[model samples]
Each structure stands twice: as structure tokens, then as C-alpha cells.
Target: MNGFTRTVMRTVLQAIPTILGIIVISFLLLYLMPGDAVDAIAGMSGSASQETMDALRDTYGLNDSFIVQFFRYLGGVLTLNFGTSISYSAPVLDVIMERLPSTMILMLTAFVIALTVGIMVGWAMAVFAGKWPDRLLTSTSLLLYSAPNFWVGLMIIVIFSARLQWFPSGGAETIGAALTGWGWFLDRLKHLVLPSCALAAFFVAIYARLTRAAMLEVLRQDYIRTAAAKGLHPMLIQFRHGLRNALIPVTTVAGMHLGNMLGGAVVVETVFNWPGIGRLTMSAIAARDTQVLLGILLLTSVVVIIVNVIIDWLTTLLDPRIRS
Candidate 1:
């Protein structure tokens, strides 16, 4: 097989173990969590009879053996049929899909901003190694990295939203806002700014420090000296040679962060009251909506696996040493 094909095959093979592990682990954990759907709904609904609870249990297939119920859930997922949410009385997939777009937009925006700003800042710090710029970048990155995300989020809310009244305090858009044209697009962006900044703050710090450290290490190598001796334009030499080598580690960090961005959307989304998957998941959990929780967990596991596979492939491409 060719390089690309081999890499694809390897990724697929690796995914099998990951998928099976997640299925088994998630099933066991869910089963172990106290209270079945009937008990949960009964407690919440109140004044429920034993017969009604029994009927509800049968309807959810919770009456089946643990192993049987697990396989049934797994089968439904594989068939793209996640059954229905006990709490919402809607198809599980429908509930998840309804809130997916908002999360995806937030994560993608944060990832792009974090990477672009991070790499540039890191490169600048490396260029001015051991100087005032390097020290400043290092100190700032450490401080930001140590700061709490919720705290940062609230500060953004207080400063930008409350004090200046420059941005919306919460929600994806104004309650009755219409999604028609450029006006809606601009408004949506305006709402996205605070949450995106809160999410990207720590990431920017982490990536900047990581990239700077990697670049510093690469710059000490013989090839960097050789490139300098060749009299290549300083900009070209640093970008083409220094940055390329430095990217191997930075790429790994960025890719992992991308996967985390999807999961971590909950914090930013909740704080901003954005209608994203994280908020959806939180509601499902609060309502004891098993189907929605299971579906979301499975989907998130698959995404994280895909991200790692992509990272591995990129590693081989970036560093020929890993290709064979």
C-alpha cells in the first residue's frame, strides 16, 4: 500500500480498539450510576404508581438484563437509531443535532484564533530569545495559563459586556433575532467574541509557550546554523526551517486542544448561555436523559479518536523520520 493508504488503514485499525473500549466502559459506567429511568422520572414527576413505573421501565427496555440492554443500546447507535430521550420525549439524535451547530462554530472559531495568534507570538518570542520580548511573553503566558477559565469568562462578561456594554452578555444571538443576511452574521460574530476570547485565552498561552520552547530547541541544532551560514534571508530561514521543525510539537498540542475544544464547549457555552452541544448535554444529564447522554458521549469519543488519528498522520508528514 502507498503511504496515505497505509496510514488510513492504521488509523482505522486503531479506531476499532478505541471504539470497543469506549462502548464497554461507557456502558458499565452508565449502568452503575444510581437510579434507572423509571425511578428518576417517578421522583421528578411525583405521585407515580408502581404500575406506571413498571410500564415505563419496560418501555425503555430497562427490564432487560444488563448485557442485553447494553448490546441493544450499542446496536441502536450503530444503526443510527439512538431511540428517544426519556426526558424530552424526542428522538435522541434529534436533540443532539439541534444543538450541534452552535458548539461546532464556537470550537472552530476558537481553534483558528488560538493557533494563528499563538504561533505568531511564539515565533516572536523565539526571535527575541532571552530579551525583554521573550521574558514578557513567557511571563504573560504563564499567568494566563494559571488563570481559571470561568474566572476569565466572568471577567470578560464584567468588563466587555457589563461595563462597556460593547457586547451581548449571553446567548448565541438576540432572542428574536432573524438569521437573514449580513446584519445577522455581524450580530452573531459580536455575540461570539466574548466566549471565544474566554476559551482561547488559556490555549493561546499554552501554545505560545510550547511553540517558543520547541523553536528554541530547534534553533540550537546544527542545521539552523548551516541555514544561517547559507545567507538565506533571515525571515525565510526562520519561517521555512525553524518554524517547520518547531511545528511538530505545536501541531500535536493544537490537535489535542482541538479535540478538547469540542468537549470544553460546555463551560463557555453555559457561561454565555449559547445553544451548543455542551448546553444540550448538560440539560440531558440534569433531566437524566440517558439516550441523549449516551449518544453525545459516543459521538464525542469518535471525534476525539478521529483527531488523534489525524494528528498521527500529520506527524509522519511533518517529520520524515516517522514516515517509515
Candidate 2:
């Protein structure tokens, strides 16, 4: 097989141990927590009899020894069976699947917005280095980077939703809108705008700063000087050579941010009341739904590992030096 193929295979193989470690650690930690699924359910019932609680513990195998329970869980995970949610009375995977699409839409939209805006702004800063434009961009990015996402979200909601009434304050759609076609599309987009902006705000700042730094570093390289001396058009040199090289670091950060967002924009999702995995995860934690919580953690770990692998592959593709 080719070197790249081998590299990819090796990376995938390496990730198995990491995944197993996550499972073991998360299982043990959760297992050692104060209460089990039975307590959570019995608490909700308010007056559940000891016999009822005992039956539940026995039925769900919560009464098993810790090692037996963990191994049983590990075996289920190996077969793609994430078990059932104690609170939801549904398979963990099924519950996650139902909410996954909304989260994906929000995260992908935010990622595109952050990447595009950050790159453009950062490139502008590089082009106007040491000038008023650069100073302004730098200051703005720092301010944004320092601000909390939830606060930004609330501020936007106040101005746009509460004051101007331009968009809904929260939710993925209108409660009972029967619209279709472009109308439905527009409605969804409107609902998405606020949350997307809030979620992307901090990431946009991070990308902008990283890209600007990368670009500045790249611009000082010997090859950049050679390209400039060769009489290539300045714009072409910047875009074709400088920007492409600068993107190496930017791409890595972008992949990490994408993975983080995929794991769920918990704060932003909670603030917006969006019915996504993040919100679901919060509910699971509050209810102590062990199966759902474990399922989310496993899914998140897998997503992060996959994203990192993709970033590594892309980096090698972008800079052949990495292949060696």
C-alpha cells in the first residue's frame, strides 16, 4: 500500500486504544458517582417503594459487580449497542440520532461562517499590516475573543429579538408554522442566525488571530521574498503562495474547533433552547441518565478522534514535509 494509506491505517489503529481508555475512565468515574440510574428514577417518582427500586436495580443489572457491569457495557459498545436511556425509555443511539441533525445544522453553519469571516478578516489584517486597518482588526478580534459566548448570545438576542424583533430569541423553528418551500427555508434560517452568530463569535476571533499570525509568519519566509522578487503579481503571490502555506495551522485549529462544536455547543445550545444533542446531554446529566450520558461521551470522543485524523491527513496533503 501507499505511504498515505499506511499512515491512515496506522492512525486509525492507534485511536482504538484511546477510545478504549475513554470508555474505561468514563465508565469507572460514572460508576463511582454517588447514585445509579435507579436512584434517579426513584427520585422522580417521589415515593417509589423499596421493592420497586430494588426491582429496577435488578432488572437493569445495576446490582451487578462493577467489573461485570463495565465489561458488559464495553461489550455492548463494541457491537454498537449503547444500551437504553433510563429517563427517556428509548435506545441511547435512537435518542441521539433524533437530535443529531439539529446540532449538525447549527454547528456546520457556524463553522462556515467563522472560517470564511475569520480568513477574510485575517487576510485583510495581514495585507494591511502595521496600518490602522490591522490595528482595528486586531483590537476587535481580541475583544471578541475575550467575551463569553453566552453573554454575546444574550446581547444579540436582546438587540435583535427583544428590541428590534428581527429574529426569534430561541428555538430551531416557529412553533406551528405550516409553511413550506422557500418560506420554510427562510424561517429556519432566521431562527438559526442568532445562535449561529453567538456560537461562531469566539471561534471567529480565534481563527482570525491564528490566521493573521500564520500569514505574518509565512510572509516573512524566504520563498515569499523570492516570489515577490520574481515579479509575480502581489495579489497572486499572497493568495496562491502565502495564503496556502498559512492555512496549514489554520486548518488544524479549524478541525479542532469543528470537533469541539460537534461534541456540542452546550452553553449556546442551552441559551438558544435549541433541541440538539447539547441540550439533550444537559438533560441527561440533570436526570442522571447513565446510558445516555455514556453514549454522548462515546460519540463525542469518536467524533473528535475522526476529526483529528482528517486534519492530519489534510495537513500531510497540504505540506508533503509531514509525510516524511
Candidates in order have lDDT scores of 0.85, 0.88
Off by over 4 Å in 2: 262-264
User: lDDT winner among the candidates?
Assistant: 2
Tell me the spans in candidate 1 whose CA falls farther than 4 Å from its real position.
320-324
* RMSD in Å for model 2: 1.8
lDDT of 1: 0.85
Over the stretch 1-324, how does candidate 2's per-residue lDDT look in tens digits? 866687778888998998889899998888888887788787788878999989988998999999999999999998999999889899999999999788878988998889899999999999999999999999999988989888999999999999999999999989888889999999999999999999998888888988898999999999999999999999999999999899899988898777666543888999999999899988988787888988988887777777677788888888888888
Give model 1's TM-score versus the native structure. Answer: 0.93
Instruction: List model 1 lDDT by residue over 222-282, tens digit each.
Output: 9989989988888998899999889999888787777667766888888889898889888
TM-score of each: 0.93, 0.94
